[model samples]
Target: MELGRLLLLQVFCAALDAGTTWLMWSRIDISVVLARIAGAFLAAILIVLFCRRAPEFRGIGRFLATSISLTCLLVSYGIFALLMLRNPVLQWPLAFAAASGASLLLSWIGYWRARQGRVSG
Candidate 1:
């Protein structure tokens, strides 16, 4: 993706993460909100880096790397959101699993769309 699009994606993802955090915590402090935004921003940078290098890998390797990066990007916010929610011990794993599953599903959809030439990046 071009630099502008990547930056836009990063900002959008960070805002989404921040919004989700605010919605979950309801009365969270500004510092925690900033932390969530920073975390998401970092994850987005890592994803962009990985995507830039993805062409170096061949076939399935490229696909897996891209997919994993995308998954992590989505899950980055969930990690903080889950921690703040602080559900019961058993529910913690369930929540994470659900988040991960959803992230994977979303990642796969994006990958499929890219493969079908439906998305530019």
Candidate 2:
């Protein structure tokens, strides 16, 4: 897949995830857009690193992945905030964990499908 198309896909996924997080949370955080954009950028960098396109930038790719991961955590936190609104005194650590886990599962499914297409093509 072309890098440009991959980046677009990443942005699309991030945007959809962020939008869902907003709807689920009942509040919009402007920063989530920035985070999503940053996440997409970092995802591109991570791809380059993971694919071994640049050995010197491996550390940078790691940093980018860490940054994107942190942003993803924040996105999960936003979703958790939305989920907790239904119950005032609910502890959110577990909810966030579950949400993150679900998101990861979905991502893995999408990644698997994408890889299959690439391999079969």
Candidate 3:
């Protein structure tokens, strides 16, 4: 896929995840909701940056990529939120950065696997 389309997909996924997170958890605390939303965006951007042509994997692989992306977003936000609960100070940036880094690492691995020529599609 083209870069623009890939980015649009990421933004769409991030926005959907953020909207859902806000609707579900915004009642808890405004900060947590916003942080998780930001984390979701960061995960997509960082994943794209590290993964590059990761979206090229197609067929059923395309669905798997999207599923993994969503899963990673949730997991990354959950980890950041849990860590923030313990510190509750100036750790939001650090936690989000780490989460983005983790997402990047995960995407890089996926990109590697996608290029291994073993996947069906």
Candidate 4:
């Protein structure tokens, strides 16, 4: 995708994360908030910009990938960040890895489907 769109998406996701954090947590911490926001921003970029045939963003696979990636990031980092900053949690890394893996797999699905002439946004 274009740099402007990408940046706007990131900012939008960050704002969402921040707003969620504020709504959920009575006492907000810095590291945890940053981590969640960063994870969301990263997820959006990975699923959208880096998806198969990308910049073009077509296909059900792309849509699924975006949802899967965003969900993984929000659930994993958003929850784990609350505890990980105070004490290390192995699940945090594992969850982030899972987010990455899911995005990659979904992107591959999109790629294969597009190759099969099945790219319809």
Candidate 5:
């Protein structure tokens, strides 16, 4: 259940990121593709760092979490690239992908830390 929730959260975050990116691109006339890619990459790095620092998820789920984080970043960027256009509704998939990816990464890190503590103890 927690994992499911985390997945959902990741998807949500990704969506938000995509939306924000689109908004920025539309309003600022900036390079939407570059901005969106950069945002996802930055988010992924942050997720990994945060998970690593988290006391709970130190070692147990590190790999899984990192995978999720990486996936979400990739999905977010991919989806944005594929769906971001004049049409607003077509972008949901990318957003969801990004969010799910982030959640998984975070969860993995937390689990990893907890396992390490247990093993040491």
Candidate 6:
């Protein structure tokens, strides 16, 4: 049941992210669409793997993971969108850096939270 919920949340987030990206660009490029699809696929796989490995991530821990992950994803996407709007040439590198940084920070937070939860209860 927890895994189901987590997977559902992942699907929702991925859909929202892709939809926002599509809406942001006036003219949709095939490369961008393909990239988003690939990213979404990878994210889904990661979520499934994490859920399987870290069964302790439930209740408040799960909530924290979901909220932080979603927030970071949106923020990263927003940064990318803003960069693309301002300066197209440097968008890819900067956006990738921002996304990568957010991912690392969020992963650490989730791991710490899960460990703390396990220790406490």
lDDT of 3 by residue, 1-121 (tens): 4324434455555555555555545566667646466546755665555445554544235555665566667776766777777777755557656765675456445545544545554
Clashes of each: 0, 1, 0, 0, 18, 0
Model 3, which residues run further than 4 Å from truth?
A: 1-29, 33-60, 114-121
> Which candidate should be chosen as best, given lDDT against the real structure?
5
* Tens digit of per-residue lDDT, candidate 6, span 1-121: 5434544555555555455445444355554534554554455556545544565555446446655555555555555556655776764545556654665465456546655776798
- Give one digit per residue, the lDDT tens place, for model 2 in 34-64: 3344444554455444435423322233344
lDDT of 3 at 39: 44
The lDDT of model 6 is 0.54
Minimum summed lDDT over a 10-residue window in model 1 is located at 1-10
- Candidates ranked by lDDT, best first? 5, 3, 6, 1, 4, 2
| Winner of 1 and 2 under lDDT | 1
Question: Lowest-lDDT window of 10 residues in candidate 2?
Answer: 54-63
- Count: clashes, candidate 2: 1
List where candidate 1 sits over 4 angstroms from the true fold. Answer: 1-39, 56-90, 118-121
Alpha-carbon lDDT, every model: 0.51, 0.46, 0.57, 0.48, 0.57, 0.54
Worst 10 residues of 5 by lDDT: 54-63
* Backbone clash total, candidate 3: 0
- Residue runs of model 6 more than 4 Å from their true location after superposition: 1-34, 37-45, 58-60, 102-121
Query: What tens-digit string does per-residue lDDT give for candidate 5 at 2-93?
Result: 34444554655565566766676778778666667655765676667755764443334555555655665675465556555544565544
**Which pairs, if any, clash in model 2?**
25-82
Find the 10 residues in a row with the least total lDDT in model 3. Answer: 1-10
The C-alpha RMSD in Å for every predicted model, in order, reads 10.0, 11.1, 7.1, 8.4, 6.5, 7.8
Candidate no. 5 TM-score: 0.52
Model 1 score (lDDT): 0.51
